[model samples]
Target: MMGLPANRLFCLVLLFLFVPAAVCGASVTRTLSTAEPGAGEVFTVSLSIDGIDLGGVVETLPTGYAFAGTDHPDDRVLVRGQKIGFAVMNDTAITYSVTAPASGSGDITGTWEDFLDETDGEVAVSHVAVDGIETAAESAGEKPAAQEAAPRFAVVAAAAALLLAGRGGRR
Candidate 1:
């Protein structure tokens, strides 16, 4: 028979054994609705899943921001006396409303943790960042009070340190 030799058959079996280990699931995609917001403003974030269910999901909002609202079924859908509800959208989109406080800049951060059937798989983790909101004071022709006084404070501190050092040297 035109077949693999015994040694080649062993190698083929080993290849099949390692194939599943190398295989991975599709990557999850996470996106934001906007890149920036004004301070103390509310922004909408849309989370989309391409190959997973829309349940058993928990999203963490950026620090100093609060979860304002959600666009999903509120009532718990029941099946056979058990609460069966869609926690996340599968092959669909979900939107969460959040409000950022009046601080921080450069990078705003958040996270999403997704699970399948409530207990069938490990949680999928996704992270997101937005350019943080800028304050009105920053936009106007004025620096933050601390920043404005930084140089003056540094000079005053240096003067005080020098005076203390001179007194100590005399002793």
Candidate 2:
């Protein structure tokens, strides 16, 4: 650390402190083909699941909606009423379709369980358009945003300044 230049030292510090957390944590996000869909219409939802080795997920659809189909293999998909479960192993993405019935609004909710890692959490919920109306949750359909990184950056900067301040004081 003493021999390294300032920029290089900062880069190395960031790489070491941040990379592990980013790599170990897993998350799921959903995207709707159309934010709004008509009654009796078939709509697609694309799920992006990353950082899993052996695990599964359960997607709970609003009542009156039917699971039309999915691109995932049938053997790995389980359908029980309005809920669908998918057994996943290292899969990064999946797409499924559902048919909206009547006119109503509801949240398309889900959860991710990482069996191998012994971790689980709610999937990022997103409001789907049913009968031309969006789901009620205003924050739906987006990833759980992490806290501001500016604070972390400031800490790193402060540490660097302290390291140089000692040398300047001696000079």
Candidate 3:
């Protein structure tokens, strides 16, 4: 009857407001495969999220870190799947490959913003330290000097061979 309809409308309104808040309370987890990375070496950064919708999920990578790609286990739908028996809207597990430049300790941080659809309730920011490639001197050592000398030696030998060939032709 008319009372039943009114009750249903009130419940629907409550759900609409409260559900978004609950959904936006997302959790973010980040893991680094290795703390120390050599120059040009590809390493993995694993990111997992529970709660928010994939469509609304925005991952912000720190400066100097390139976004290799993203991975989602449940590709069939926008929402990944359920977690802990509760409906997890956007349950995504992503692996990002990053290359560290130079040799030093670099800080990499990721922010999962707008998780709960609430403007300010983003999940905790995760940070990882990447050890840059060892110093050039330590890595290459005397090899670079040798490599540089090799080309010069080749050039000199070629010049000497050309001069000898010309003298023989004249003789």
Best by TM-score: 2
Question: Which is superior by TM-score, 1 or 3?
Answer: 1
Q: Can you write out model 3's per-residue Cα lDDT over 80-151, one digit (the tens) per residue?
A: 211111123555665656665444443443345443454322333444334534443345542212212122
Ranking by lDDT: 2, 3, 1
Compared with the true structure, all predictions reach lDDT values of 0.45, 0.74, 0.46
* Clash count of each predicted structure: 5, 1, 1
Candidate 3 global lDDT: 0.46
Off by over 4 Å in 1: 1-23, 76-86, 89-91, 105-171
How do the residues 1-171 of candidate 2 rate in per-residue lDDT, one tens digit apiece?
344465456555665565445334677778888757788899899999987788998999977888999999999999999999999988999899999877766668888888876666667566665656654453375434543333344456556655654454342
Which candidate model has the greater lDDT, 1 or 3? Answer: 3
Residue pairs in candidate 2 whose N, alpha carbon or C atoms collide under 3 angstroms: 126-141
Tens-digit per-residue lDDT, 71-92, candidate 1: 7666522222111223555646
Predicted structure 3: clash tally: 1
Q: Where does the lowest 10-residue lDDT sum fall in candidate 3?
A: 77-86
* Position 65, candidate 3: lDDT: 49
